[model samples]
Target: MRLLELTLPDAVENVALDEALLRQVEETDGQPVLRLWELESYAVIVGRANRIERNVNVEACRRDGVPIVRRFSGGGTVLLGPGALVFSLFLRVEKDRHLANIDAATAIVLDRVLTPLKGLVASLERKGTSDLASEGVKVSGNSQRWLRSTFLHHGTLLYDFDVSLIERYLSDPEREPDYRQGREHADFVRNLPISRDELRKSLTEAWDARLDPPELPFDLVRDLVRDRYRNDEWTFRM
Candidate 1:
């Protein structure tokens, strides 16, 4: 897999780029990609099917000038900022048989992630469906999106996040894994006990992914935002 380390200035553009990259992979039928990026600022990203009002504190977000946008994948809402590292994997469905089913797909990808995570922190386990937790507190959360020939498996690794921000801007998620056990965000989530470089290096080596440039239809990202992600009509359409 090829690796691309790129993040846009605008938070919505980063979300749109997630869809754009997956579509680009389908168009090229190229190598699987592992794109790692960090948001320069703060944003509240809602899952494709999530109810924004239920998952996010809209008044708090607006008061703090945080952009609330929706992505193309189904999962709970997430808060993205400089402290978080986002990894996006674009893979060909035919390349991996596990990609054909949703549960298996999530399993295989996260199982691969556990290799490096275990090395970084002890007693770390794959809890629930797509979360990496240590001693029952989540450090990473993931979600997926599929197309005809390719799919996207992306998630946030809380390498150095501020947990308080989540309490301020996000309401209690409507959907959660059983392991969460109705705990508040502050109690349920924690940052990984690893530096960004260490975590990035481990993931890159685990996947055998080499760093690459931004070669995949950059124009499509802007178009995606213009047509869908950046528009409040589409973002809040539910």
Candidate 2:
């Protein structure tokens, strides 16, 4: 597994970078990967096949000047911006069982990437096929794509994001269906007790024991975005 830390300008680049990595993992039949980074600004991302108008509050986004983008993977709508930590895991299927369904695929990610964050209160657990919860509240949301036996797992970690902005910008103003039973952005999302570097170091150390590290030139990710993600059709395809 190669570990890569990328410091990039927050644009629509993540979507393209994820696609490129999925292709690279399939092409080389590579080891698992732990790719870490952060968003430089704000962006609204919806799942593939989601109706942008229905899933996102377009008027709220427009009023707030928030850019909306779509990801190549499937998951609920989410907001990414500064104070959010993003991580993507690229893995090669090791067994037939791991390729069977989304549930299993997500379980694998939870075990590898989140189970070790024990110091952050409680260890993470799957809230659904693509969510990680701590102390009965969600701390992260994930999405995945499996291409030719390779898995691309990407998600956002709310280290210290603006919880209030979620109510202002997300399509769900009330968080009715989901937040009915738990702490949500406006009510509870908070900054971690530890620093970004410390948390990252802990995450990296946990990943070190799982796969071999490879130095993927940052250029590969940079070039893919310029050619694909920063396009109007890809961002607002409603």
Candidate 3:
């Protein structure tokens, strides 16, 4: 898989890039990609069809001047900011049963990701559906979007995030996986006690990902940011 080492200015462009790359691969039958990026500021990202009012504290977000954006994937709301490492995979789905089913996909991907972290951390495991946990606290949260021929799997790995921000902007998710067990965000999510470079190196090496420019159509990404991600109509549409 080719790696795209790029980070945009904000959540909107970054999120738009994920979908843009997915479209590029599907249209061109391009090689699978592994994109890694980090946020320099704070933002709250809701799932594609999630109700923002139910998942986010609007008043808090407004007061803090943090942008609340929505991505084109189905998952729980997430807090993104400094110390958060995002890894995205654009893969072609052939006869791989693991990629065909959501549960199987989550398991297979998490397992592969954990392989590199196993020696760095003790007792890393998958909790709930797509969460990677260590000693009962989540270190990573993942979600997916699929097309007829390819699927986009992306996730956030918390390396050293400010856990307090989660409670400040996000409400208790309306829907949660079984293992969550009603735990509050601050108590449930924890940073991976590892350095950013270590985490990135492990992930890139695990997938044998090579570094390269995406060569994607930037026009589509800009259009997506303007028309969908930046528009409150689409961001807030449940």
lDDT of 3 by residue, 1-238 (tens): 8988889998899999999999999888888899999999999999988899999999999999999999999999999999999999988887465587778888888899999999899789988889999998899999999998888999999998999889999999999888878999988999998999999899999889988766977999999998988898998887
10 residues in a row with least lDDT, candidate 1: 211-220
Writing each residue's lDDT as its tens digit, candidate 2 over 1-238 gives 5777765565466666777778787888766778887878788887876777766778988887887877788777888888888888787776445656677777766776665676564645666556766655677788888887888888877777777787666654222235336544555444455567766776777667344456454576677666546666765675
**Candidate 1 TM-score, C-alpha based:** 0.97
Best-to-worst lDDT order: 3, 1, 2
Predictions in order: lDDT: 0.89, 0.70, 0.91
Candidates in order, TM-scores: namely 0.97, 0.82, 0.97
List residue ranges in candidate 3 displaced over 4 A.
95-97
Two-way TM-score contest, 2 vs 3, winner:
3
lDDT assessment of candidate 1: 0.89
Which has the higher lDDT value, candidate number 1 or candidate number 2? 1
For model 3 the TM-score comes to 0.97
Residue 96 C-alpha lDDT in model 2: 42
For candidate 1, the C-alpha RMSD (Å) to the true structure equals: 1.0
- Using lDDT as the measure, which candidate wins? 3
